[model samples]
Target: MQAIVVIILILALLLVIFTLQNAMDITINVFFWEIKDAPLVIVLLTCLLLGYLIASFYFFPKLWKLKREYKQMIKFNSELKELHELNHKNDRKPVDDNSDPEGIELDDDDNDGSTFFKD
Candidate 1:
């Protein structure tokens, strides 16, 4: 996998160098002013860097906020679990059918199996 990645990176770099060598002529436009004779790779890399900078500036804060919210949610869930355990610690009796000989109530509505309002 590492070798494949290295080969791909080398090919990409060679492609960029070949493209740059082929296009020696480049123009730079900055706020209505045109500058000439700039190297193609320099301009291309500069544009790439500028794009990355702009995107990072716009997106990094949101990424950090998401990370913070995720951490807070994890902490809140852990605290909720701890509170539940603490609250239920006093009553630790086994209530399963296999454990209890005397069966517990299965229904809460007087076991009539019919609604009071029905005919």
Candidate 2:
């Protein structure tokens, strides 16, 4: 934040110097409309602001979608973390070594290729 403040201060100083140095009046020709006696800094800064506003409007939808996707990823990450902790907790339980508690029968190689766990 301090670096940002410093950069802004430097930019402001540069702008002030530029504006003072280029204080001469100039004319702007835009298509058929001719603007007379306009300051160079005012014209340049106005164009810069208009460009910024235009670009922001053009990319607003894409920016909103990216923000939404980022939120979904955060939610998914939290849910995955909870599932991982639950699995880790289940891993520390005692084992029977005969039949698994999840209904997975061991040594039952019937070769039928059918799952016993039904929905």
Indicate which candidate wins on TM-score: 1
lDDT of 2 by residue, 47-73 (tens): 999999999999999999999999999
Q: Which ten residues in a row have the lowest lDDT in candidate 2?
A: 110-119
Candidate 2 ranges with C-alpha deviation above 4 Å: 1-5, 93-119
TM-score of 2: 0.62
Worst 10 residues of 1 by lDDT: 99-108
> What are the Cα lDDT values of the candidates?
0.84, 0.91
The residue pairs in collision within model 1 are none
lDDT of 1: 0.84
Per-residue error for 12 in candidate 2, Å, reads 1.9
C-alpha RMSD of candidate 1:
8.4
TM-score of each: 0.64, 0.62
Q: Give residue 11's error in model 1 in angstroms.
A: 6.0
